[model samples]
Target: MSPNTSAGSKQHLAHSHAHEEDIPGTVNLNAAEGDDTGYGQALFPVPAEDPNDPLQWSNFKKTMILIICSFYSFLANAALIGPSPYIDLWAEEFDISPTKASELISYPNLAFGFGSLIFVPLYLKIGRRPVMLISLIIFCAGIIGASQCTTYGGLMAARVIHGFGSCVCEALPVQLVNDIFFLHERGERIGYYTVCLCLGTFASLPAGYILAGGYGWRLFFYVEFAFGAALLVLAFLFVEETSYDRKSAILMSMPATESEKASEVMGSQVLAEISETRIPPRKSFAKTLSLWGRVDNDVPFFTMMARSFTYFLVPQALWVIASFGINIGLLALAYSYTFPILITSPPYNWTVINSGLFAIAAVVGYALAVPFTSSSDRLAAYFTKRNNGIREAEMRLGVMLPAMLIGPAGIILYGVVAEKSLHWVLYFVGGALSYFAAYFYFSFTLAYAVDSYHSNTSEMLIAMNLGKQYVLPNIALILPL
Candidate 1:
């Protein structure tokens, strides 16, 4: 009582202490007297102090990686679909029915989807680089295997192996782009990647003629094998591991490695105290490749998978209907199946390999889309800022509206031209129009889904990829093709 009363009696001392403690721009709340509503919080939580945060990656670094990965996807997918024009040749050579020979493409596609079930999870657990490198090796091996195969069964097995390996390319790029880019940036970046992917379709068309140019079908696989091997080596050197824990950036600044437990202990204590904060941490290329990152202990893989299923229930998700339907319908079925037959059959009487010209249409379509590649991102960002830093999930949809009409129109035109045996230019024009329209939908819708459902992107991509890929070729495209 003597000491406490003496301190209380020192009014000037107390006032000075109180004045010093009451600093400007500071908030003081009595936790014991009020409910903790977490009113004082950042609008967007800054990433934890992790050097390995994808956000910490430089724009140029991210772009290079994106380009490489997208290119791999383009080559792998091109290799798979490029051989569609050779179906007639396979049928004749193997002495199998065209229906039987078509199984070469269909069965491999099935393997493509299932390969994700293994590789996607493994990438999440191990690191994207390792899985991608392994996949490229397998892809090259499969291509080499296919080049040597003499029997239809052997060729089918080799194609399946290659399809399985290429499957990771689809998931990894979307995942990597998501990992590195922001909400506003996703549409354009994805658009760029989508264009590369679509170009693969065109690139493969030339392979049909390559088969006809005296090199045979074996040359197509051999050429693809060389590209796949080159990409594999590039991936091992460039596509480093991306998994990281963001919480340990502070205590680990001593130029010494810290245990995960120590990092977590300090991170939790500091996190509990900060009401509003900004984090800056040391960065390095090596950190980007570490298989450790900030843990969101709240989320689990199965929970993430479960939550992503709800995206399929969304309206915009459903709206992708006509775009993907028509695009895949035309590329895989109409152009892939029909063009080859039409070009090689009666009136047209074109060579069996000339079926690849449809790919030129695909190329023209994608190239035309180049100017507008940045439009969606810019539009979304503008609208987001106008909304006072609030980003609506649907704002990006505006850019896609133009595409809706464009894609459907292309499909109808292509259908009519094919039905009437119209001039081949009409086919290319219709295909380009349809392909360009589909490009907007692919990039924007994917960006929308990623933004609306920020968590569990990989799982959503899995469902999306598996569902569309399986259903389109099997059901919708099959009818038209």
Candidate 2:
């Protein structure tokens, strides 16, 4: 047995209580006797005694998992959006309409969202590690295939393949966070993931320069492929199987040292009990790499998909879907498509290469918002304390209020400036302001949803990814028309 498991078992035997249901907004700061992480006196989702419990893992191990998963989120998004500047280039090369070429980005984006339908349930039924590894391999294969494509059809297929493969990038990070982190830390950690995710949009700026250097668009895929391969290896080494089925109530309130009749006379009662009562021998390192995951007989595939759709009826889930969809469609895609056309036209006449420089607005905007990423968590914590340790999901929603109007206002500014042919700098000002607010909405809204509902998080993520995909394409179509 590993030292972690050994220690956890001892702790379990020592503690007097099992895990309890969490109130929506409040965290149990003190879960164990003499336990204090400085924030509270209780532990929420009381961790199991098994070393295999993700919560029982050391901080170093948890941080490594977060870093690797966050980077994957970054790469998946960068690959999806990075090729925006290449629409015109692909159009010319393939003798297709720019509209048709733009579909390369659009359709693949749909695939990116829909991919959750297949992968989420797979992870839930099988395990996170194997699914993640398989997805990474598929993503790398698609990237390599795209790098060598000679036709638009070939490229589109490759794009879809990669987009579908990497779609888990959107959901996996959030799921992993839910699995490993505590209630107080979720907001800040999710913020870190959101920052990396937002930074992916900035890839267009570098992609433009890459094209200007005469390396060709295919080189971008090649570079991403190289990174994907490296990440796969890193994941193999660091991303162990996090899918442990914890047994409930494993600790006894009092131990029985004598015969059953004597113990009964002593009035010893059970305090905890988990699913697996006996400690299993630890598997070797090689055993961790085995692709087979324990199949969850209870989680039927189609039923899980069906249940995920019900999250759409949830107000918080709906809010997250709308937030992601509007920002991605209106802010990211709309701006990417429009800036290139507008800046390179008659009055402004910016060179094609320089057109993508507008992405710097996004860079500046997200960078400014980074410090505030933990604001929601802090606000929630404060409210929880004020409420006598009872937390409400709405506690975090306040931080979003300031950013709510800012993004829409920026959109209006961009439109007016474009319509009137105003100063070029106004475009940058508008975009930066909009993206600034988008960061808060993007980060906090999702965090709020997770906090509000303690249901199957993986299923909620599926709904989130699927909802945004459907919403974005419609907006992308309507805006250009």
Among all candidates shown, the one with the greatest TM-score: 2
lDDT of each: 0.67, 0.80
Q: Number of the top candidate by lDDT?
A: 2
Which pairs of residues collide in model 1?
Answer: 244-292, 244-293, 244-294, 245-292, 245-293, 245-294, 246-294
Off by over 4 Å in 1: 1-51, 92-95, 247-311, 314-326, 340-352, 416-422, 476-481
Model 2 residue 75 lDDT score? 96
Residue-level lDDT tens digits of model 2 in 1-481: 1213334445322121323345554444433453433254344555554555676666777888899999999999999989987989999999999989999988888899888999999988888998999999999999999999999999999999999999999898898888887666788889899988888867877887888888899989989999999999999988877776655413431122123345445444431222224443345668767777656777889888889999899887898999899988878779977988999997999997788788788888888889997898788777767776666778888898878788888889999999999999999989998999999988888888887775578888999998988888788779868
Candidate 1 local lDDT, 1-481, one digit each (tens): 0101233432110000001013221222211221111121111212333434654455556777898899998998887777876778899999999989989987887788767766776677666777777888888889999999999999999999999988988888988887766444577888889887777766555775685577788888888888888887666656756555533543443232233246466685564344113334445556545444333444455655555457567565555534454567656565666777777776678875566667778778878888898787677656655654445667678988888788889888988987888887888898889878878877777777766555566776766766667557655534754
Estimate TM-scores for all models.
0.77, 0.86
